[model samples]
Target: MSTETTLIKQHVIDPEICIRCNTCEAICPVGAITHDSLNYVVKADVCNLCMDCISPCPTGSIDNWRMMPKAKAYSIEEQLKWDVLPAELSAEELAAAGAEVGAAQEEAQAAAQAAASSASAASTASASGFNSAAYGATIPPWSAAHAYTNLYGPKAAEKTITATVTGNLRVTEVGKQDGQQDYDTHHIVLDFGSMPFPVLEGQSIGIIPPGVDAKGKPHHARQYSIASPRNGERPGHNNLSLTIKRVLEDHDGQPVRGVGSNYMCDLQVGDKVQVIGPFGASFLMPNHPKSNIVMICTGTGSAPMRAMTEWRRRLRASGKFEGGKLMLFFGARTPAELPYFGPLNNLPKDFIDIEFAFSREVGKPKRYVQDALRDRAADIALQLKDPNTCFYVCGLKSMEEGVVMALRDIAQNAGLDWEAIGGALKKEGRLHLETY
Candidate 1:
């Protein structure tokens, strides 16, 4: 092949479908994936076609590829500015661009080989590191309902679906005047009047916050886990809900406004917003009768937990489904900080078993979700033994290690082979972790 016929297989993330979940960036072994406030972009020069970021992506957006002339491969800066993936180069266009068909075939085979080698090296390094993301599954549960995604996005005929704010209510308590920390979480509901948007439990939707950033470019959409069941937040309504916490302070106690969080939390009833995606297929709930669900989450992470629980609850309420055990291990700084505290307590023990961990209650020891999991190791061990049980963990990235470690210890103490069990969990799509 002549030098001009050299073709490069460029890996890319689909900005339209991408939720900016940061999973791809975190999993990329070579640090080739990066993001600005606008979009996540892959550095062409650094990427090794390793495929590490492909499976961990909940949105399926990281699997995109474009064949380009070696000299004309897209730059990270160009990819960052994309609202949608550029059109694929047809055979004629490729040839005109000086890439022969046979050369393209050779390039693809070479790319595959490179991907396999990089994947092998990544796997070996990952085995030595305690990466919880390694345990995440890419496939949906066998009994999961069909999920609809990317119905409206930048590349679609309709750029976005307009959702009207039906309701916005504060779910947590207001802080006192004496410099008390405010746990300001809002339960916002949006109604799509006539849009054909369908979603499932554990899925997410992207909200394009109004206005541009400091760079004067349009704000990229932000993904939020769906907090409502598949039926609807209000059954039979063409609507859904999200649990959003206003970020008045950063992790270091420094005040900073979260562009997306603030935009979502401040929405009033009847306000209009642009939305994209019903992203995520893997994190869905198991729909088979007697399929047990083990949900572990914290703060806003409870959004998808609520979706799954409510879905199961709705099914049980219908009296047609004989559901299995539903277990929830939820954590918060205090009882007051917990979302749906009143409603969660109101749930019948026969319907769902809930364990609440309060880390900052004045009179109580700082019990976290992992501590709560260990406290009920007997029950957790039983669930682990059951082939029908599926475990779901979602929370801050800091909580992932401890929660997974707790499960590992529980398995080991029960004389279970963790390697086999963990492998089975991933292979069978029984264990899911979503943290950022």
Candidate 2:
């Protein structure tokens, strides 16, 4: 078979930086993105360079592109197997590989135009649809601190930083042996010792599980949200905390253990674990004074919320800063299932306003986080209009649409312009959604 001479700019995701958060997979209009338990990849034939998945990515990994011969473009299969992106081929190398290097620009532009034309008609309806992922901002707020990412990564990662486990405790009550939902989450503390792994409030760390997959390759890194303030999990120590749920069952109600979550939950205090990244940029909390935060979450999604709240609490305790209102809406099946239930309540009422929704109580009516949002429609409407108030929603994938729709409904009922409000949220980095 003969190969084509024209070169095409291939859109690829950097697996090293990607957190497997599912944002890109959700936002890609043409279904170009897909993922397994390992990595997320873009299909060369399906991807049209539509660029819709670029901005909503929290880690900025989806913005990478490589010029390659169209006939020999990287396939989704090849990409999913990569631990790191292949180095770019030079012009001479491209020509030697049966591509016309000089025609790269012309072919790239043509592909882009065709993609735009095909996606144009659907864009209008997509804009009108209520996609929470669409409203997710790709940048941090104006007052957010400088977050450092990709400081250390794969490729010579054997020499990368490793942290010692200092503390491991169960935060939630023990569930029944047969899954009665009593919160099987653990609070794990990792001490970097003398090494520097600077992470922000919303940033995540990639832990390489000490095992291989069914394919016999090393298990890819799993991302977990940091659950402590940036200063340290314990004050003044070189440590951080992670809230990890022991995955005993798959989403299908079958007995299937999660490789990464189980490995993390079972670590001992003296164990050493390989770590990489301090991934994420756009999901960071604002550092300026008097900036409000509204957090809505379910289950272990409360990890990042804990980080931001603790940081603000520390600042308030120091008496050096005057922080604004902090409101939290946390949902769980029962009180015992909620991680940090005791600590979250122990926070001063004057310092924070919290709402809890329990849907599976024995006798009470079912209530979800969205129902709580509607119950506080008036207050939420006010916050919706406040520029200083940043709204963050993190939880299961199923909760994303309902929560975003709740926000839209609140805006509409208040006689506010939802179009303008939603647009500003994306443009000004006021809304962040991180559902797995």
Task: Please provide TM-scores, in order, for all candidate models, with all chains considered together.
Answer: 0.87, 0.90
Compose the digit string of candidate 2's lDDT tens values, residues 144-256. 99988877675456645799999999988887524453338999999999998888898888888887889886776777888998999988988999999988777677777
In terms of lDDT, model 2 sits at 0.84
Error in Å for residue 169 of model 2 = 1.2
Give the clashing pairs for model 1.
none
The top-ranked prediction according to TM-score is 2
Clashes of each: 0, 0
Name model 1 segments beyond 4 Å from true: 1-8, 29-31, 43-46, 55-60, 66-108, 117-121, 176-182, 250-254
